[model samples]
Target: MLAKAFYPTEYKKQKENSWIRVCVRFLLLITLGVPSNTLGSFQITDDISKLSVLKQNIPRDYNISVSYVPKELAGMCWVKLNIYYLEESLNELAKKFGNVSSNKNDIKILIDMLQDMRLPLGHLDPIMYDFECHFRNEQWQTEQYFDYVKDLLKAAEDNISDDCDPPPCPTTLPTGKGFDVI
Candidate 1:
């Protein structure tokens, strides 16, 4: 016990060819203990339309907006204001915006109701919104949307146009690529 404690083995006399093994062990230790690369977190952004769909919060995208319609005298007008609200689906979208049609369940009338819908700038019309939705969501169901839009256009041309009314440009509808148009 006394010899073991007093005459500890010296390092110079014990090992001969372990330098490579030592370096490999040190490198492996560093590779395992220390982080050599950083990892990135995944993220998904919430859009205004998705907010309406999710119904998680108040929709302020169209809050600070107003509409103006010139009266027959060209000097004054009484605008019928519309307050935008989120609906569950297309049926509800039509039911809530009933002023656009005599038939409440009419999808064509619902498309027309978009005219009353406004953006945060209050510069939107139904036709514009229709085009905006289509333009914005490239994956949107165009055939269904266009069927209603065409019907609304026909109704406007046949029953509403009085020569003094603004012409409907169904063909030149805006295709929004981003938030610029909506």
Candidate 2:
């Protein structure tokens, strides 16, 4: 009754009609390319300095620093860092939800994706090695390095699944006071 008062039949119909019109127009615009003016301006550049500036914009946490990475290594380091963070997040998610049968397949897909990514990430290790050996010793800050490695190791240990038992799936349908029949 209160919903009817707030949104009368005529108003609801008009609102729904407007929404449908919007969706149709959007679909039409997609089917027919949008006007050039709507896209605004875009430019491609091979400028190295501009690349460095763009690289600076990549997000970072306290544990990772890209500011001191050499220009040649900046891009590879960024990729490695992103993969590391993604693998960490997925592992955490797996630890939390992978026991659920429904989530196992999705987690496996993510793990497979990570494995694929590790190929490219492995190729970039020479860049990382150069950065660590040649550039890092001089430019890299070490104050938090030990703490960061320690935390990373601890997280790795926590995410280890070998020690944990998978949750058991029920063969029979559940029956209890709280269970409802469909």
Candidate 3:
């Protein structure tokens, strides 16, 4: 046949390369359509800044109710809950995927974000007092409280639809596709 008579190995290699190039182009086309404006960064909820909720939820008595906590404080309560949840999730991920997995990167990023969010020593009293009475019930370890930060970061990452900035606009298009880039 024509294939056997010609440079067959070179032809086969060319075909393989074409397939890879096509696949890459197709993936770029699909992902590129997602606009930059639609993307958002991973960050804490803005509910903490609402003065009205803070006024209402700031405890005036020794007894506190976690259910009535403001959104910002509720963010903390969720962080507390997530510490245990993430520990368990990581255990499960380890069991399924062995020690190394994609989730490990996510875990590391979460840990870094949590450390950044840590409350300063000076402002810890009222927050800790309310957290202990309303959220912890009895008493929670300081280490455990800090550990919850990983969960907060993970949650924020999950909440963000587009964690990274949109890819740069495509500057060139293949001549055969007859595509124009503006």
TM-scores for every predicted model = 0.16, 0.27, 0.25
Ranking the candidates on TM-score from highest down gives 2, 3, 1
C-alpha displacement of 10 in model 3, angstroms? 59
Locate the minimum summed-lDDT window of 10 residues in model 1: 73-82
Error of 1 at 119 (Å): 35
Over the stretch 118-163, how does candidate 1's per-residue lDDT look in tens digits?
Answer: 2221443543343332222222232333333333333322332213
Q: How accurate is candidate 2 locally (lDDT)?
A: 0.39
lDDT of 3 by residue, 25-83 (tens): 99998877553223543444332233233223333332211112222434534443333
lDDT of 2 by residue, 58-117 (tens): 223322231223224334244343345445444644465436544434545544544444
Off by over 4 Å in 2: 1-77, 123-182
* Count of backbone clashes, every candidate in sequence: 3, 0, 0
- CA lDDT of every candidate: 0.31, 0.39, 0.38
Shift of residue 158 alpha carbon in model 2, Å: 33
Task: Rank candidates, lDDT, best first.
Answer: 2, 3, 1
